[model samples]
Target: MNGGILHALLEFAFYYPLVMSLIWMSGGIIYFLRWERREPSRVRPRPLPDYPMVTLVVPCHNEGAQVRETIAHLASQQYPNFEIIAINDGSTDDTGAQLDQLMDQYPALRVIHMSSNQGKAMGLRAAALASRADFLVCGDGDALLDDYATHWMMMHMLESPRVAAVTGNPRIRNRSTLLGKLQVGEFSSIIGLIKRAQRVYGRIFTVSGVIACFRKSALHDVGYWNTDMVTEDIDVSWRLQMRHWEIRYEPNALCWILMPETVRGLWKQRLRWAQGGSEVLLRYTTRLFKWRQRRMWPVAFEYVMSLLWSYTMSVIILLWVLGCFMPLPPSLYVDTLLPQWHGVVLGAICLLQFLISLLVDRRYETRIGRNYYWMIWYPLVYWLLNTATSVVALPKAIMKRRGTRAIWVSPDRGLR
Candidate 1:
């Protein structure tokens, strides 16, 4: 192959990835514009006949160290007519004992101990069955909710009776290490952008499991969480939407979750999330075009495209790297050719968008310093890390050999 042809092929290869990124960025911008224009005041609160009974359910497995603090936080909620139920899903540690101690201190608290580990879905199922409340507030045992978290979530639900579920913001509680800081930035950009998009579309794609409120009737309508899939949260969200039920994103309702402090820990946690997401896509792929509602189609398309893009971009990155090292045939090179000017322009756009995301992060409560230099470097490093994870997850999820059934790995615990 001639040098010119090889260069052309390399350039074309670059354009494919650039195009994907551009599409994502464009969608993100549209989402932001729509979200900014939304009038929060216009969405007036509905006067509830009474403070509906709420059951705050915490599903735990080998999270003994964090259970007490989590329970204490739930017990501290200012909301009236609420119960705190902590389901210990067969914790090998002293989680049962910790819950027992809390039960004695707070009579409103209830504990359910399982003989064996049955993952979060089963734990939540058990907790929901035990509670005799009008609403269910499901959260992780390692999560800490803000004082007004439940109140705001309930208000949102009341305001939008069509909404089957309400999801709150999940902020990183541990940003002491470099890894943690990068995660904070990544989460702020990705989740923040997605939530804004969801608000605009009036269809939330997935409710963060860290803290979400669900109408008991909605769960019953959709048949609750699917224990078969690894990502029950996402599965349940899709099911709710399929039933013509609405889901709301409440930024004011806040919950803090611990991020993985170490690189290894972070990788494992991401693997489970990525794999679970893919599984949800696979399980619901058929429902994509079948759903009669227009809202459901867009949400389904977004999720399917996201998964495909992740794996496709990973392949493009690898091809680009190989093209740089090995001599390729002229035909292959030309087919993948991208212009240098396009690369420069695309790179600048990505950098600019990333900066905007960083600014959004600053608006939120972050422990990291608000330095311009640090923010610039943070996004680049975080993007690289995310790309690497997506690359690894592509194959791991394909093999269906990764992820754990045991709930011992608690990334949220370290955040507190």
Candidate 2:
């Protein structure tokens, strides 16, 4: 690469994140002021004129240790007129038996035993077909849903017929290790801010797969979740939006869940996420040029830019590593590897972004600031992890054949 080109790419690597941080910070603040401040019941569920029948769909695969607690939480929902449906997606463990025992305990609890392992998408499709309710709250088997979460999500669904889904806030439950602790900050500072900002930008890229409420009609209209997609949540989000349905983000709806504390586990999870995103972009980019799809233009464009940024960073890192072993052009050596004023500015911006997210999210999670010290490692650790995963996962996504069934097994749930 020429010296000028190297300088430009180095500038992009440093400034891209700074620019995005400002966007997220400003957009998140605007969203909170306009939409979140005036809510009447932020902590509890308010009585509605009528409580529509809803089904809580839980997809379980080898969740023997966690299913009991999850079901116990679901049975205690504050919302009225709701039932629990747990689908055992061919678990090799005791997940099926536990759900069967729970079925005997809670009259509202029902269990579906898949003879063989089908993917989460198939499990959800089966449950939706069996469900008698028009609205559905879907969550992971290991997740603990707040008693009032369904009520908050339902408020959005009931308010507008166009609202197809409402994604809840996911809080990390395990923070014993440094990795887990940093992830707590990550979810708040990075994921939470992006969702709020994207909502303000007029379309969400995807709903939280761990916790979200859906309208059955909207799912039907979009042909339900794509069974072959690596991440059904992302695929469904795009399809629903392309069909002109709306998806909202509900910060008040909280779901406490476990994350991968180990580096290998976290890498696997993020790689799947990145590949799913690439698959969605490749599948839908051609369709986004129409006038009706103008609203989604920003989302697609942002994702493309992010992919380019990831590759750019990866190349810089690779060149830097190579230079350490041998000689390189002076321009590449100085601009890419050495710290400068831009580095200081980037660090300051990261801190500001974390502070902004913590302030906006503290309403949902009290004591969120307790994790502030841990966020010091986020910029260095997560940026590299995400960049590497994006670079590696793109090729995998492209190579994946059509009509491949995306299956699942239980992931690392951190230390007990």
Candidate 3:
């Protein structure tokens, strides 16, 4: 084992992410407290006003059988004044024919059939153009939007004119695989917690595309969704906020969505996400300097630090693998992951973070939290996977030429 500089770097590699996670937890708690202090009506009230005409955009590529369930969910939303515009983006399957049949059964539902497959951004944009409503909700064809989700999401937009988009909390539907079960906690511990904290900080890196609500005016102001960005969710979130439209996180607006069930699928999904973040950074560097956009500096700084930590850890791991050829000190080799004091401390930190997030998100559990025991291995797996994904994805994103068409891919959700 080395002392001084090497020791410090090793410590930094372990604790940097831990410290940031703690900060996010604290921020989310603070936000929760503020919400409690506010009036109940202000937090979120029932029987939302006006019942304004709302349009839902269903973007499909090759949605297969699951879209039947998705359309059923849309047809079942409890909201009074809403119309469905389901976009069949040139699916090679019977999705277009299926949608046409569904449309006849549900007259409120209108079908938009694209002759050729473009991408989600184009599909959403086309739906937006056809829509007569000011507010629009977009979701993938596999997601199950709660009957009340539209009401809750609509409330946020009606409450404020500045609110441009409300990102809904997505709950995992498939719990069949170990990977799927692990992600149930992953959403609360990582994605959900970060979103709550980032909202309190006055900036969010991106919206959850799986379930999101948008204002047509805001989309028009930003020129609608950018087709070039691989992740339209990241691109649209940045574009709206840069134009001074607020993006709100609506936890009560629950959308049940499926996630990847294999290491390969999980890796691909995460790499795509990481690459999307890098693309947003590359495309929007100039906007970050504007005086009005200063509030986003903290958000930008956090992302930059995340990348630095990921790359530094990757280099350290490579060196450690090379050092494996030679004999190492017994003390240095002691339980790098557990059984030692530092390992125990780091593990405790991860556990505490998840517990805090779990507390805040308990209301939306939906029979999912019964698998909490699986998350015992969460702290061990989350960072290791993220570091490797970012290491590979960032460089790929950079090398990719700008203006590449953003196509869609169906994630491998382990469901029979």
Best by lDDT: 2
Among all windows of 10 consecutive residues in model 1, the one with the lowest summed lDDT is 36-45
Across residues 216-257, which tens digit of lDDT does each residue of candidate 3 receive? 999999999999888999999998998889999878788989
lDDT agreement with native, every candidate: 0.71, 0.91, 0.84
- Model 2 clash pairs are none
Q: Which lDDT value does model 2 have at 212? A: 97
Residue by residue across 41-119, what tens digits does model 2's lDDT show?
3566667767899999999999999999999999999998999999999999999988998888999999999998899
Worst-scoring 10-residue span by lDDT in model 2 = 331-340
- Per-residue lDDT, model 3, residue 160, is 94
Off by over 4 Å in 3: 1-5, 36-45, 326-339
Query: Which runs in model 1 stand beyond 4 Å of their true positions?
Result: 1-49, 291-293, 321-325, 331-373, 378-385, 391-416
Q: Number of the top candidate by TM-score? A: 2
Over 18-111, each residue of candidate 1 has an lDDT whose tens digit, in order, gives 6544554555567555543352321333345568899999998878778888988898886878998898888888999888888889999999
Clashes of each: 9, 0, 0
Judge candidate 1 against the unseen true structure and give its global Cα lDDT, from 0 to 1.
0.71
What are the clashing pairs of model 1? Answer: 9-333, 11-337, 11-338, 12-336, 12-337, 12-338, 13-336, 258-412, 258-415
Evaluated against the true structure, the overall lDDT of model 2 is 0.91
The candidate with the higher TM-score, 1 or 2, is: 2
